[model samples]
Target: MFLTRAPFRALSRQFQQSVRCLCDKKDKDVKTTVWPPENKEKRLEDWKVIDSTELKPPPAENPITRTHRILKDDILRLKKYIPGLDGRTTRQNATMWKHTLFGEGEGFPEEEFFPSHCDIVIIGGGAIGSSIAYYLKERAREGLRVVVLEQDKTYEKASTTLSVGGLRQQFSLEENILMSLYASDFLRNIKHYLGDHVNVNFVPHGYLFLATEEGAEQLTQNSTLQNRLGAKNILLTPKKLKDRFPWLNVNDIALGCFGLEKEGWFDPWSLLMGFKHKAQSLGAEYIDGEAVNFEFEQNEHIQIQGVPSGEYNSTNNLIVKLNTGEVKRITFATCIVAAGAWSGHLAKLLKIGSGPGILSVPLPVEPRKRYVYTIKSQGQNQPLFNSPLTIDPKSTTYFRCDGLGGNFLCGRSPSLEDEPSTENLDVDYSYFDEMIWPHLAHRVPAFENAKVCSAWSGYYEFNTFDENGIVGLHPYYHNIYFATGFSGHGIQQSPAVGRAISEMILHGEFTTLDLSRLGFDRLMVAEPMLEQNIV
Candidate 1:
């Protein structure tokens, strides 16, 4: 009982503090339930009752936002009851609230239901989809009915929520630098775009990328490209790194590139929420369901069977099948495939790109798992004072403050071995101990005794072709535009990519920025737009 009560009260106090920050819910009745017993059956009984009635609204607010908060509350409460398990279990339980929220006896507003049709439908309503919706509606002249289809209503499994939220313009390629530069500007003026009421908590402490002697030339070249694109990057020597960041162990570091101004981390969930709420306010309808299949109209279908040479025409119409057993036949002229890791699978449904010797370019995007660890630094000797996002390029290790004092976030670069089951959202605690901790401790010796509070795994939409984003319309399916295959950098690149896609939809080409280098033509011709700075 002591074990259960202690954690519950602590969590409840933290919850109340956090809730005070949310202005919309401050006036409303939002209940935080706490159970006395540690039994699963008793906890479930209480949870069911609270979830059914606690969120009943009097004062109007965003339903999805309200639901997310409530589910998060329940996750913390339930996590306290489960005993003798690892902290990662709490993270996993917290991530699966969609299963409980949208289950029996829980439902959303009628307007929030999966619509039958719309003017524009964007799949995968994560950060990218939401951003596109926001931009499209912001620039729309004729009130275009934009709809976003997201399978995870709570966004518990989405990479946007799980990401470390580091934004930087330091890149080996010119296109990446330009995209990140646009993102930096957008993030700075985010309030003007996302409304004054919302705050994303952008921390521009800057990013420090440390490279060994072997990687110094490429790092220098990257810094040059970044500088050419108007980015404020300073090449720091080992002594400079030590002076700037006293806690850094720069013994093996040959050279470091630091973004002085617009490179840092932020609250990813807040940015996503801002985009979602703004898009919703601008009349973009968001649906909750998985996109299972695609239906192409006969006019849109190709005559590969009859002709000696299978010449492609265009897709007259597309029908998207939802997991909830609803089929939507789109009468709209355009559909944006921004499904991230699932984009390749979605493209396969249209039969645009599949096997060998096909004229159409294959979106070689696949899910690669990456782990994020949350740790609390205890000792006085290990003080991380206002540290920027520090990365060891050779070791593929990175760490930064988690906004909460004494707590820090860290992760290691995903190698080829990390590529496993796409459905696996479970964290590998062993990986932190075996792979991550060793390298991180070597880089920052203080991390040797750091306590891992919690951890979770996220999937990157890794593009095997170039490891860069694939944007623009498909050559075969002109109606279908792509904003997917951003690999791991989707959250930081969402603003620029979203704006570019919106421009393409509104003005028929990229007006604001020329994103042609990330087009489908590059993928088709096997021209890889390589981005060497990947972490």
Candidate 2:
């Protein structure tokens, strides 16, 4: 079978060409000579013709019109859930609902209409109050009606807006530490909870606490506890302190505790607005008004062991005075007092201190005016951009870089005997010159040339009793709860406090953080959950 190479190759090529020619002839015959040859033209035309109708694009839809259509459809779908809704009023109600959710045109009121009754009434529409509203509505959605009453919508004197917006986990108490930890996490993932458009502008700068020999032991203890509870901080000696912060005067400093992470400052106003907008979007109502008084009724059926059978006053209605000089009463199933500095006053309206037994103890939360001064230092070897929100524990003076422009914010809490008047939010510039400047100059010699560019004052919801937040239900009133008395930490702890309040209301217990020790029950027992690291 082995033929010569050239002859074999020539023969194989001839055979392959003959097979390919036969296959091509068979395919041509099958393609041209189908069973129904008469309809060949129709079959060929069908293959060639494309349906232009199917290829045509759909008409463009206006975004506004599409939004209206979607809203209308949603209204119709939700109409069934509303009992006693008739066909005649469906369109009108739907239009109102659309305007309420989306936007208001002329003749449509921008203010939230007063409701006669709601599930919960929150007194004070600051960051803490708004947060409670947000968390409640977020959990219950339309199933819950939450109303927040604020005296000032502008928030000119609001403690939340006026705060320096510092967030740190350096604390002596476990509750405060845990709350701050959650706050850092909440602010970090704020977009997931509040919306993608919301930003808190969190600046991740650590807080440096400088302690004298007298306070060195306490500082070390606090640092140890803070680190044990997932907080990252380091204790540095005098030499290390000077090395880390060369501009700092550590000649008298015995120890220094510096936070490594989850400690910083943010825009308090932004956070407050974020809570407010999200809460409103989730069906919480914010009314521009002041909580003037409470209407209480004695319930004979309900009895408490400490109170007489018929003397138990149950608070279910709140009288609010609107910004327009109109007063209205709102009945609520449960009420929360988060009035910040004014919480103590609101508690008085409920006869908290005037009443008998457990109500004798007031909220102990009052307004303590604190001043913040912004200074600019152009001296040589001034604190750099990396400088933290530094604190001198002995002097109770603290300062932090305001921006990259060599501006710094400095303040000090007044001595107990030298507390200033809180009649107005007036900043006393003399305070900085007499009380704060000397300490600042000593801490950083370069601060001697710093000039006060501006200054402002804010009221701390100072808890006179323990200087801690008064949370949970009041012993006298079963339906009343408190999320106030945070002193100066309310802005940072608003998220955790709101969630804790919501958990208490919705689940009848704290499901996440056990803040029982911070409850009003502690006030009755006269045990204060005091935190040593207070600025």
Candidate 3:
């Protein structure tokens, strides 16, 4: 049979056309179903007949053609539309998109390095880092200049690239919900700010969290908190859930909260690129360099050497040096660390806001590894174009339909103890089959029949202490600040947190939404705002 890869609407339209043609032919031997010939003709008659040959398999396809034809054409047309980067042929651009789906290609020519500078420096070019860069540039147009330091120009290894890309307002904390709301709004208008050149194919299908008896009480409480914030997602009783999702098996579920709106997954890398492109266009510079250490000067009014603080440093003169065999020096007036997992180490070195700047900075922000497995299942054989994301609280196994028939990407968190080495990102298969599969089978019996086809691993910057985000200025240092330890929800909250961080860096305070709840002071006070929605 033909593999169900084509767009549903398009294929449906084609089938309808053929059916109408066949029905119109002047033949009289007609066989029909429950409805009579007249009823069938009056109904959606065009769908009554389908070509027998269409049921057969499609001819063998090539590994390197067809679908790429349109992609290549678009790349060629959009090249001159974007500036800054040297002219790249369509073939080169095609390879880039291919690398996005598969492995990276041969390295490109290392261009002659240009010595550039900025007033404020941010380390990292992924979601958190790029957001800080963009917001600062937008807010501090007159006096603030920003530079984003990225170790990998493509950000292939960043958690932003490997995220499940889910967004929700079902968080237990008010600030967390508000921050995500800000991001949702920004994402809705992303094309406007980033440009029509960028398009994030965001599907607003909601998420359903099935609460188990073990966690039902806390989850229901969380739902109450979420609902109080005007998020209409209600906690469904087993009966109510059955009424809404009759197709689902809710025998094992206790209380379930379904985010019927304002939640879903999207292409993570696209969102990152959108921000980066706009930031670059607005004069923010993104350079390649991992921040191994920081240079800070201690005094009544402290100043970090490489970073510039418009208040203390010369205007338009920003630079930082990369730690290489040859000392590469770059100086910036101010510095913001958005280096995800590495933020902990960077903060330790600067002695700025360690453990929230005073009482104690016991941030349980540790790097943990997890695996993502995409599998083919006999259960969901049809193209899952409209399935909602289902989270089983009992098993902690999340399931969603694959765009392609008979397949979906699924995985689970590894306990902190058994996780991969913070530095080794290598993928392990046994972890999935042994740890994830048993739990998955318990929640969704349908998944019991699934088999893993492909898998990958990435890092989660776990906020171990309270599993909450840490935002705002570094307590000890003046110009140095941070927005890290978001745990896994970084991408969803990056938009608002980024704007908040940028506003703080430029104007010395929060202008829009108040972010006092996520400040670094939590560590010192020994009071952390914990959220219960962590997966």
Best by lDDT: 2
Question: Candidate 3 local accuracy as lDDT?
Answer: 0.64
Question: Positional deviation of 450 in candidate 3, in angstroms?
Answer: 0.3
The CA lDDT of each predicted structure is 0.72, 0.80, 0.64
Candidate 2 stretches with Cα past 4 Å from truth are 1-112
Clashing pairs in 2: none
Q: Which prediction has more favorable lDDT, 2 or 3?
A: 2
For candidate 1, lDDT tens digit of each residue in 1-535? 0011123333453344335335433223322233343322211112111122223324665655754665576565554336334344654544433322323232222332333335688988889999999899888723466878786768777889988888999888887888889988888888899877667788888888999999999899989878888899899999998887777788989999988988998888988888887786656777765554454434424544332344444442344444454444443457899988778777876666753344345678877788899987665446464788888777678888887578888887667766545556878888888877888777777777888999988888888887889898877665788898888899999999999999988898888789999998887677888778888
What overall lDDT, based on C-alpha atoms, would model 1 receive against the true structure?
0.72
Instruction: Report the error of model 1 at residue 33, Å.
Output: 37
Which window of ten consecutive residues has the lowest lDDT sum in model 1?
Answer: 42-51
Model 2 C-alpha lDDT per residue in residues 96-118, reported as the tens digit of each score:
55554433432224433355466
How good is model 2 by TM-score? 0.81
Candidate with the greatest TM-score versus the true structure: 2
Q: By summed lDDT, which 10 consecutive residues of candidate 2 come out lowest? A: 25-34
Q: Give each model a TM-score.
A: 0.76, 0.81, 0.73
Per-residue CA lDDT of model 3 for 266-367, tens digit only, reads 888988987776675455656665554443332434454444453232121222333231223344557777878766656555543342224135445666
